[model samples]
Target: MRFLGSRGLIAAAALAGTLVTAPAAEAAPASCAVADAMVSAGNYWLEHGTNLAAPDWQNATFHVGNLATVRTTGVSNHKTLPWAKANGYLLQNDPKRPFFPDFEAAGEAYLDLYTYFHPDPPILADLRSRISAEVASVAQGHDDYWNYVDALNMAMPSFARIGLLDQDESILDTMQKLFHHAEKEIGLFDEATGLWYRDARYVGTGTFWARGNGWALAALTKVLQVLPASDPRRPEYLRVFTKMANTLRFTQRGDGFWNSDLLRPWHYGGPESSGTAMFTYGLAWGVNAGILDAARFRPVVDRGWKALSTKALRPDGRFGYVQPVGAAPGPAKPADTAAYGVGAFLLTGQQVANLTPGC
Candidate 1:
């Protein structure tokens, strides 16, 4: 189950008016309720969402988190194997955006299937061809490929995984090159605030988006998850992860959710599940990994799980309040939901499931 990759506060006692004056009494009961809730939501998604093998950013991401759920629950491999086979184990490389990261976002899920199931060699063929081309492109002095913040998670983690799998440090180094371009050359990251702008336009605009930071943090955590502890570059990514975690620790709303506009919560002030679940996933991962102090971050993880399980997730298993795709902060209503949002929840649930009674 270590192919990859805790929590508490029986988020079962969820909402007290969109914003609770104080969080409900929450703790990680011995039941490990988060995992059970995770499976419930996962089943909701499986029944209502698209077929798992659909080649798109949303479904690809769902697959990434769904597989994590499978491992956490010890569910059989029926869905993943058949799906990977139906799709021919290919990455989503659209002809128009040949190197577009979204098109290739499926690489993360594909690689996970290979690692978890140890599928046939053909499972890696599309990644080798397409990502090898990407490596060559980066080597040829092309650093602008990761033009947006989401690309960090959409594609970079897959590159890092391939680097470790192939035992190619150069590919890992190339990933840093692209990250450097986006983080520094493009000035998308704001170290002064320990957050990242969604793209070049959002820089210097005094607007730190919740989902944007969620995407960046999840990517950093994913990279660390797959990187060797002894790798010299591990600390660099580790610093970025902890700094962002520290910033988020202060900005979380009282109701256990982060508003879409992080600093200016008034912009779209409400419980946003996509960003909240993703942030929760990263914090839980950091704590379980021992890079983040448990005392400092466990409360944040607790509040987040409570909010998601209680507030955003509907009784019928629909995880809602996800702001529709955009570059800036926007309002998310209870009825608003997507596969990607549910995917973030699934990822969060697996991590929360690992928490040992929140201590």
Candidate 2:
């Protein structure tokens, strides 16, 4: 229940000090203050929780977009589906398969909020059990194009956190296995291009999906953060992450966003907010973790923050132009609003909060 004991509290206080010491002149923009606001917002939704499938975007039960709405405005309708169903309970239409990808995203959201708020132990335990059960069920014999990767990414943070809390070796081993499977399945090295593919095999017209790559980049950074420095796999994860980061850097648009299609802009439209936000978060994390050159990445990060703060955010703090859920890059229509887009925005804002003072 109380994962952060005296030692953890001390470490967190030290980390907070490092974060706050950055000069006030470099403070994050006012709108960006919601980065910290998420702790309260997330807690409000969890406490006054609603059903997950009310089709009301204002409730916490809706997808990533709905979550964003809840973060911005704490009032959500009760018609929302219960947390279980909202978090990808199996549908009768697709009974055999769970909505693993959505569960993964929701799991991350819950875990991230938990880190900041240190929610009631029962709340934390319930979420952990649900997520772990979904992951264990999905991992038993499931295989899909990208669902496995999604599940692994979603499960890693929770498992690591749980392991740290209970000294649970099984949890740690599960995390390791998930990572290995994800690397072998989705990760590919291109000798000619010296970049990693979004998946192991390259379709003739295939290029890296910006968000998918973002997911991978973020996952690797998170995994490495928890992995022991001496772990043999740590260096390999770093190597892959570096390669992906370089490719991402070269692909960044002059406007500070990645194109919908990471390889070629001609085929796709302009810069995408969701992918750009994810990449911004990933790059910022890399710099903060000392795995990448901050100077080299700062401009990109700055441009990204400016673009998101100015272009994507509405006056009410709603994030737009997020590409809706899909496996690969597609038409960036105005109608394609997604919760993950807002999630990505929040993620970027959170990182920017840390960067502003430090810069």
Provide the overall lDDT of each model, using Cα atoms, as 2-decimal numbers.
Answer: 0.80, 0.54
Give the alpha carbon lDDT tens digit for every residue of 1-359 in model 1: 22221111111011001222343233334366676676677778778775455777788778878787766665433566676678888877667677888877878878777765554568878987888888898888888989888889898888887777677778888889889899999998899999999999989998998888898999998999867778787887888899999999999999999989999977889788899999999999999989899999999999999999998988888888989878899999998888889889989987887784531
Model 1, poorest ten-residue lDDT window?
A: 8-17
Top TM-score hit? 1
Give the residue spans of candidate 2 off by over 4 A: 1-95, 98-101, 126-149, 185-205, 334-336
Residue 104 in candidate 2 has what lDDT?
A: 39
Which residue pairs overlap in candidate 1's backbone? 6-351, 6-352, 6-355, 7-352, 9-27, 92-103
Q: What does each candidate score in C-alpha RMSD? A: 9.1, 7.0
What are the per-residue Cα lDDT tens digits for candidate 2 across 1-359?
11233333443344223323322122233354444333333333344433434322122212332333333333233222344345443212223444344343444444433443333344355545654564465467543423333343445555655555555555565565556655554444453443444554453345767776766676676667666676555676788778878877888888787887788788676758878887887787787778889888877788887777676665444556677667677666543445456556655655565576521
> Which residue pairs show collisions in model 2?
51-80, 51-81, 51-82, 52-61, 52-80, 52-81, 52-82, 53-81, 64-339, 65-339
User: What TM-scores do the predictions have?
Assistant: 0.89, 0.69
Candidate 2 contains a number of clashing pairs equal to: 10
